[model samples]
Target: MTDQSKHEVQFFTLHGKRRAYVKAGEGPVLLLLHGLACDHRTWLPVIDELAKKYTVIAPDLLGHGVSDKPRADYTLGGYANGMRDLLTVLGIDKVTVVGHSFGGGVAMQFAYQFPERTQRMMLVATGGLGPEVTPLIKFIQAPGWFPAMGVLTLPGIRHVETLALRSAAAYGGGPLRKYTRDLAEVADILESWKDRRTRFAIRHLVRAVIDWRGQIVTMSDRAYLTEAIPMAVVWGREDQVIPVRHASNAAALAPELRVEVMADSGHFPHKDHPEQFARILDDFIVTTEPATYNRARFRRMLRSGMARADTTLASVDTALTTA
Candidate 1:
């Protein structure tokens, strides 16, 4: 792995708003998207390694990270449009998108909305596969959740809360070990929430996709579109937030999906197993051909949509192993 500290975040302005991102290395483009409440830093683990061979562009999504967070669109489709515009401004034509968690939903939407610009897709512990999600996410939808966050971020209280979470994250053994990283991540998220604007933005973003019943949006309906785009889905076997089972759902919907479940990893596979994650990603890009968009074929699929709906999901690979 290369020295992550050496990678500096660059900024760009779009629509009069400033956005922060990290661009490194050179070659074919690889657009890395981080999960909710996380910024481009989440990709630091594998960014340098991947950057060695590919031009890696990891952006802090509009509402997350240091990006300007105003009263702007935060829906999945809105996010997809934002990515397309960003790519346009950067003068990039096509890319193999890599998205984690909420970013995964945006990746799928990006491909769906602008297939011509998408070369391939790589999803990590992605959302929008199913309605099942962790209670922690659902709890955000609960009334007073925003107010509660405000209280938690109070000066003295914030320090104590972050300290407790960090302590739990440092525990070396027993069941807590399995969730130590998650605890640490939660602490980081809490720290970020100390900024009132970020808290407000996150609230709107979460409400747009989640509800009491879990994730309200999904990619299952359009999974058949993968026939025109090569996609690989990576998930941690023990991902408590999204659950590894969701990967099975995705594979079932798109038989062509390359599924890999990392053992002993939770939600953040790239963080827990950076080397393996980078290797798998590099190998996939090397082995699979980038998708070439054909207008006629896309049109036929769109025309045959309802008739072929039931036939979309043909088989299942419930086994949590590399495809």
Candidate 2:
């Protein structure tokens, strides 16, 4: 049986709605957060492999997978708090949080909100780091596009999509070929629009972070607060959904961010190189010391020249460690 099949999804009720997730293995806790229009299933490629050494918990955020589609809070902070509640129920406090694309934003929020519980962070082609994003995403979250999406997501549209691609390939020139190829990248995303719940979720949830003009809620300024956490960033060089340059931009903002670029992959590097992704994540977790966040010290850093850390890493006490 495949790793995907081996793990059975368990359900956890939050706010009177069920959130489906897969919980497996034993050891240090590791939470895998999926990107937009995705569920915990996205982690199946690396789940069992990484579960060998760590307790891996991958959840279907409030609206994505088998989880209930309630018109609830789907913002990063909301997602982060939901994760904390899940961890609390399982009696797992500190964890290494790994997020991909949209999940990356949630991971950062998780670290910021509950620093003491965040052991480390790993972002894979994370979103909400910059203003640059796919025109498709920008348009999907646009104001006037909501009503159009209703018609666009009609079940028959998928058949139309296939026919259009075939026609483009058959009769069209270089320009149409390029358009079709680009459309192919997001074809699955488009297919997902057929689901009314998914469409609603994507429309509402994405708008919370993104606007018609790329991403609106950027976390660049908050990078300084992560000085104490060991972080890694993995980006696909060919990521068209979110540019690879955002990885460099994030590295510039965050201190000691270990950025790894997957040359051959596109938007989903973890799926492209699951074994390597798992290896990179395992190495980081095993080698680095987990960070602890003290609320008082966290506040102090904001006040004490955040521009330059005249202060060292802060622990439970006010004492500073010059790491």
Q: Which stretches of candidate 1 lie over 4 Å from their true place?
A: 1-5, 310-323
Residue 270 of model 1 has an lDDT of: 93
What are the lDDT figures for the candidates, one per model?
A: 0.85, 0.79
Write the residue-wise lDDT of candidate 2 on 163-237 in tens digits: 575565346555344334334335556666667887788888888998766677766556777787999999888
lDDT (C-alpha) at residue 314 in model 2: 30
Give the clashing pairs for model 1.
none
In candidate 2, how many clashes are counted?
0
Give the clashing residue pairs of candidate 2, or none.
none
Q: Where is model 2 poorest over a 10-residue stretch in terms of lDDT?
A: 314-323
